[model samples]
Target: MEKANSSVPKPRKTSVLSNYEISVSIAFKRDCEVFLVEFAKQKTLSYAKFANIWQLKNMSYIFADQTYVSLLKTLCEECFAILTQCIIHQKNVYMKIGALYLLYGLYYKQPIEGMVKIRVSYDEYTIIKDLMDEMAKEKYMEPLFIFAKLKADVAFNYVGCSMPRSIRFIKNTKKAFTAHTLNANFGENPLSKFEGILQDESVVKLQDTCKRYEMALKKNSSIYPNIDQFKSTIMDDLNAAHKKLFSEDHSTPSEQIETDLKILNSRQEIKLRALKSENATYRGAKQVLTAIDLE
Candidate 1:
């Protein structure tokens, strides 16, 4: 009789997080209630705007809170999972960038006592690497590059080393390219000053965001041909409509002024209603409304 064939089973892959790690992650997420509440309250703010406002207005009180350092430390530990969920599951670019910003602040401001280590399983590492690659191909270049750079910084800092200058150089190049495109497109405007009053960083960060968006649009131009023409057409129509509405018909100066004021007020009210509806629909539309009450 022939000998029976024998086969050996492959070992199953396990999670990178240990039981302690899992427990700590759960506790940390629970502790994020305060952060979540703050986020929801200001969910309409852009990440940069929110960060700037928090730094100027609330940083001191937040630092004095007993749970602040602990929350930062927990976030540092769980940064990978948080970023992954934001990028992959939630598809929220702002949240992904926000999580990285939180991790970056934690690294600089509140240093942990001992060596804080992050260990990734082979499978998990592969998943992250693939995600980064996919984002790169999709022209989501800014966040993809930033996340990679930040992840390396977090990992190396935990082990008491600096990331190589070469990696930093590459990341900076990507950021500059996006920023340059935006600055060229928008030019300088008096409107930036108006935006600065509520959130000082909004204007600067908005330029950067616009550059990234412009690049994305250009990359997918085949699907959105005549976008620039469309914008010009809309602006021309708006200007013509405005001129028709406020045309001076040889009325008395005071009467003309009063009529103009009424037209402006009516237009402002319509804009405010539209802005509120937009805020309800989008995550950060309120920040776009310069006339909204920031208080």
Candidate 2:
């Protein structure tokens, strides 16, 4: 097996490459049966394989290059389907524990850009909440990677432009053009407070109209997202309140959404947001080294 190398020194906790990881790398090219036998006996293969898979140093190159599109395309549909099935079968505790480790390995090893759609669904708040809860419990070094990705996606993708009122050009236009009292005011619900529009009914009608137009535009103003585009699943699981509220809210202007998206898209800086900690920093520090150790 080829030993992993990087420009930076490996942190003390994650310094050595494990035998199971080496075997898995070997298995990636060679014999699966041999590796599985070793994995059962040692329990080390799973750990090392996963660790090697999500190694941050190796991912530095992808982050350095701007191949966002390439990264998105690399996600293997077949593999993701299998992973999702595994997640669905397990209990939440086991799911949270095992999935975080498994995903970290997959993420680090593959380092695919725009590849997050496979591991976890961002739209599913429960999945995000549980995974986060699990992370809060202990010194989970690996789960941090997924959390960073999620925060970046939320900050730049969901919270940033998804709300609409946060954009600059729209703010200026509202000031110059719209005299509607609500037009300039962004209410507490950032999504609803955009320029000159506040009535939920009016917003929903506008959104329905826009959805129609967007459908047309995609099909050269002819086609729309249809049954074929979606999986056959129960729509009943969707909350009616959310649907009603979504309908009532006017979309933040498309231009604003596009602009905010562009800002996130063009971002080159690495996104690093920490997960919430159950232990206070001092407590964590105390566990690491008692008063005598600092000296």
Candidate 3:
């Protein structure tokens, strides 16, 4: 009698790509084939080539088509492998830098989780990381400084805080007058009392330093300014902000405040550095592309 009450098992669920997704996959594969053909001949990638191969429309398909996603992962791995080889073999610096630009573009295009994991031996990872670090240390600072300014805006928004009119005034001041004006009037303003409450040192320093870097970059377009300047400036700003926010006289800060501060300092620094390095590589790629007519 109990056997008579048994129910039928349900069928396993499966996903299928839509007709549009299938078409996207076909178009993407064709593009990859074209890119591979060019890559085979030149043994390097360029910004224009990469932009042509990786169209914005194709990128939109990555999330919708599992097959396309897998294909993209495969493509990224192949490019990364080429990058590793370029570095390991000590190939032409221009080619190596070009490969790096392509790799960064791919890595930044989609979410890391969606992309294939970079499968590298520990030693390989170390070598690549070291190279990247060296490059970052010597990267142009203007882009990073600009990123820092944007980071400050995001950080203030994170903690539901807004800059005072005095800070805004400092930001809008002419570059020649900014530093002097800030030094003289910063502490005297009524808003200065709220600096501790607002935790605006990082924002202020970021804007000020960005302006300085902008001027410097404009003056010396050929020189690759060291990124260490930005790091030092931001670190000092963060330290000052930290001391103000958690003065010895104050009670222990809440976990949220601590987390936000960490994000503003560490995460923002990491992001700015990465952006700087990527941009430098991209610029180098453009130069190399111009040197060698791919047509």
Candidate 4:
């Protein structure tokens, strides 16, 4: 309901175009409902067939008029509701498979000017997740994979909206770092303890060992490093440059996959200015003007 806001001004009720949309919407809804039933049984549908039901072509005179907007949302809700019922309530696996294909087509099909868009509410998606988990517990994983395209992709449609996403953070370890402090790394460091070797080796011998150790590190050592006697010398100034650049408040080098997830799952921004801009200049990718008035 929250995503139902319209930037396009409501058209005059008495206008000829507004009056025409009423009949068009009525017929469109009837045809769309019929398509669902046919597709569920047939297990297949073509774009040309569905596009005719959608009623708008890429450059059709159709735009976001009042009746058109109501129909826009209604089609999505009805299709999803029926599909959910078929998947959850229907006992026949073949019927359920047909229903799943119907949904798959709805979500992935290229509609007329992208008009036949399908969006799943948060509560609705949870039903599928619970079903998948139940199926997994019982050792039936095939049916679950059949629904992967929809279940996996529906999260992208839910994010930045009122509905919370169902799948998030494919992999996360909770290092809790940010660019402000740049804190990172987790778990024990391989080189955490630094016990200095109290060997009686001379400075010149230690320096020679340090060079040998460096070569050994890169697998370029002519012979074995043999620098255990100069352990302290090998780390003579290990933290010196790092200490000068950063503070004692530091951590081990850890990997981050969460930052990318954080960016992808970020909340949507309110675009007040975009609401009043030119059609192509704003988020009006599918916008249609109803009257002479401008935004």
Best by lDDT: 1
- Mark the 10 consecutive residues where model 4 has the least summed lDDT: 178-187
Candidate 1 ranges beyond 4 A from true positions? 1-47, 53-93, 113-115, 151-295
Give the TM-score comparing model 4 with the true structure, all chains together. 0.28
Q: How well does model 2 score by local distance difference test? A: 0.39
lDDT for model 4 comes to: 0.44
Task: Report the Cα RMSD per candidate.
Answer: 23.7, 28.0, 30.3, 26.6
Highest TM-score model number: 1
Q: Which stretches of candidate 4 lie over 4 Å from their true place?
A: 1-77, 88-93, 112-118, 137-142, 155-295
TM-score for each predicted model, relative to the true structure:
0.31, 0.26, 0.26, 0.28
Error of 3 at 36 (Å): 12
* Tens-place lDDT digits, model 1, residues 123-157: 54565567667667877665465556667665533
C-alpha positional error of residue 78 in candidate 2 after TM-score superposition, expressed in Å: 3.2
lDDT of 4 by residue, 1-295 (tens): 3676588789755644334434554444334334343333333333333333233222122223435555544444445444555565554444454455556655454233444444454664576667677767876655566577655664225424322233322222122222211111211232333222223356457667778776665563335455343334344574454355445534432222223223333422224444555553534455677666563
Each model's lDDT comes to 0.45, 0.39, 0.44, 0.44
Instruction: Kindly indicate the candidate among 2 and 4 with the higher lDDT.
Output: 4
C-alpha lDDT (0 to 100) for residue 244 of candidate 1: 61
Off by over 4 Å in 3: 1-72, 110-113, 136-295
lDDT of 4 at 150: 57
TM-score of 1: 0.31
Model 1 residue 228 lDDT score: 59
